[model samples]
Target chain A: MFWQVFLFRVALVAALVIPTPFFLTQAHADENLWGYVYGTDTLPAGANEIYLWTTSRNQKGKGNYRAWDTQLEFEHGFTDRFQASLYLNGRSHQISGGALAEDPDRRLHRGLEFDGFNVEFKYNVLSVYKDLFGLSLYIEPEYQRIDKISGERVNGFGLESKLILQKNFFDDQLALAYNLTLEPEWKKFQATGERERELELEHTVGVSYRFLPHWFAGVEGRYHAVYPEFKKRESDAYFLGPNIHYAAERWWFTFTFLPQVSGNPRIAGRNSNGRQLSENERYEYRFKIAFNF
Target chain B: MGLLSNFDQLTCALSLSSVRRIYQAGDLADDLVKCRLVVLRIKIGFPRQGVIMRTAQWIWLPAACLPVAAISIPAYAATYLTVEQAQQTIFPGEKLAPANIMLTNEQAREIERRSDANVRRKDIKLWKVANGGYFIVDEVVGKHEFITYAVGLNADGTVKQIEIMTYRESYGYEVRNADWRAQLAGKNAAAPLKLNKDIKNISGATLSCRHIADGVKRILATYEIALK
Candidate 1:
């Protein structure tokens, strides 16, 4: 089943990439301006960039769990309307002393592990510079290996897509952006020979004000929903935060912090008392630094 | 190997200021031929290797097209309108004399405080019409750039016409539209010329509209107190 899913994802990516090179014969240029929380714009044709980012998520639970994810990405613009990127991802975890900390089996070891890889493509359908609201489409495929602390392994594959929209007002001093994302994943447990499938939908909205020449400040809100077997709605979450961005001629940086306001954990029956409980995260923070060449 | 050696020499020659100066002086025909020969030699040296040759071709192709692209872009004249042209358009063939008005620091501050906009220049030019009116040229900040415009007021202090002299912003060129400028006509110092209230804003040119409106208000006040 995992092999079938992986093959299907690979085929889909191939279908999209096959016809791209035929139209990439010309080179053009455009601005690469962006907002902090949501991807609101595309790079110019023939532009190339490298990005490095890190995210930390803290969860308040039995053992005070914390997870860190890091990614390095190479992005290129094939034309004025299309962009492609590849990401190398990794993760690390740490647990503090608490209810589940005494059990070595329940606590995660503190170390970095190779997570997986993802390929992303984006196409701009409408441009704001041409007196219209901006619209873009995004598609991505991801593969991951769940590394074991002692000797447990799980693997997963996923496909995600998004519709992004943006608009500018007050002579480009203020910008508003929105994104809707859908993802489906298949996970296989090697030891149990069991497989599980899940679907997720997420919505994000952001507003930014260009306060200075190269500085922008904004706020973002996010809503996440999960479905088991693509049928029953199992859980949901909401997060809101502030973000800041700084852009220069050759490079840019952005930082954001989000705190989960409400949500229920999917595996509520696994709690100590076997009661349905909230699984909302305490906070999450991310920083990205990118360079254009 | 000989081609590789010539490629190195070609790069060194292109990097020299003397070669650039010679090109600027209109004597680069011979040097251009040498450069072309070096490029041809490099291409011929790797003809059998398709991948390497294609990579080299892509690198030089855009470089060769740069001059054409640069020359193809259209150039516009300077954006400013001279005092004579501005007076002629505002008064239509009427002889107008230029008078320089220097504002006191207190008066400049008073104008800024009343209009809620920055007053960058204290010295202003007022064109006195022989018949009866004042033509004033002023500038205001519009989204990191200055927008220069001319304001004409009748001797009775009512606005006659407003014409944009130079607009420096890439976007919000809609502020230069005549319909938008006509909104301020007939407004006087006693009338409120606030943006979004008295002067309807253009859809995508809000900042420019607001700044220009505020500037018109300030100019009206200046005329009322100093020149009227």
Candidate 2:
């Protein structure tokens, strides 16, 4: 009887608190300053926004390669520290001979294909405004039938979660953010009945300065490691670059040009200058635009 | 890796994160000690299953904090003061009576032309002092929020003091500094009231500074045309 009562109380509390953010009465913040890093800020309550992202991954240090990914995201703020989003994902890649067709290699994508979708939730425990430092927890669950790199039809499911931290200075003229992310995925091929489990750990940091009222400039760095089948570390990559952002009244756009600084490719000798190329691209340029309503 | 590990412990503390105890710049030194303690906690908690970094990071960590020693983050918000408090603070022993004024379109346009500031509203919120001075409440657009401030003028129509009643922008909180507001005191309609010229502009809060300066100028023009 005691255990049953405890479970009932827990379920009742969860039911009441889980739906509080969906009321959509007030909205707070709708601007993003970095391309790859996230800040621990949220909308007030009852606000809606749309975001469009275009990311270009180019150059593999060997053979001409290019990939463009697009995501149409709809975001809603339930409260000051809680928000949710839905995404429509699309991906296209072009590669001309870099030993991807070799044995034990993966399939490559050539044209535009619609990938699966992703649902994201974020909750802030602390904010930079009143707290010593800002901290937020973010989680996204993704399901994809097409491989992002190979574009082959496969059953892939991924769960990505991150801890975001932010700090501001100089009357919010200078802002810094950091994110630690872990993603675990499982994929199974329908044609060959092949199974794969992968784990990824990533750390990203961004420092931005509002040089002008409507303009912000920053630099971001990312270090990520991939573990195939959750065993040995397969590859590790480093990226660093500059980002620029412009915010209007209800719309804002941020762009970043990140180049792979160094990495361990561990691919069929397709590395460039000892940098990872086959598994990771030489550079990534991402542009994001958001509209608040 | 070490910094990320530090954040994990910090998250536990953030879970208790109702920041009801925050201080201004005067208490920044104590805050630095708190930050160092947090970093110390991170160092103490860095023994994981596989990661080993006890000596190598300790030797270089102090030098890494040199750049961070200069940073201080403060929150900006609305609701700095209220009208009754501002009235008492500006006009200590004297009583003030409501002397609100309404302006015609031509008069508003004329005030705008003379002061180079837009007259946002026709009806002005003001009060007349027993000593023949006045107090006015006005609002101006900031980058993202609206700023409401009160200006107290002298009997001769010059600015006596400027008080920021509420400032809700992401930047430009420095406009509330008494030293900066001192520049506006004793200035009449002959003053330029231009930001970065007669009035020093805050580095990040340019819009707030400019708008407040423009509002002051318009208020002076209003006194000359409507209240004088």
**Each candidate: RMSD to true structure?**
15.1, 21.8
Model 1 CA deviation exceeding 4 Å by range: A1-37, A96-105, A147-153, A190-192, A265-280, B1-228
Clashing pairs in 2: A21-A78, A24-A46, A25-A46, A26-A45, A28-A44, B172-B205
Which stretches of candidate 2 lie above 4 Å from their native place?
A: A1-28, A99-109, A266-271, B1-148, B151-228
Write down the lDDT of every candidate, Cα atoms only: 0.62, 0.71
Model 1: per-residue Cα lDDT over A1-293, one tens digit each: 33433343233223223323332222222223332244545666667666656676665545555666656677887875788898876555655454232243455444334567899999988765333688899999998765312113568788999998888775456778889999998878777777878888899888877787657788888888878699987877788898887654344566778877766653432332321123334677776655555
Clashing pairs in 1: none
Q: Is the docking of candidate 2 incorrect, acceptable, medium or high quality?
A: incorrect
Q: Estimate each model's TM-score.
A: 0.52, 0.56
List clash counts for every candidate, in order. 0, 6
Cα misplacement distance, residue A38 of candidate 1 (Å): 2.9
- Per-residue CA lDDT of candidate 1, range B1-228, in tens? 254533433232233334445555665645865544432322222112222221111112212222333343233223756767777777897878888799889888888777655677889878888878999999876443467899888878888888888875434567778898888889987777765568886644555777788788888878766776
Tens digits of lDDT, candidate 2, A13-98? 23222323343222234578998999887654566766667687877656656676766677887875799998876566665566
Worst 10 residues of 1 chain A by lDDT: A23-32
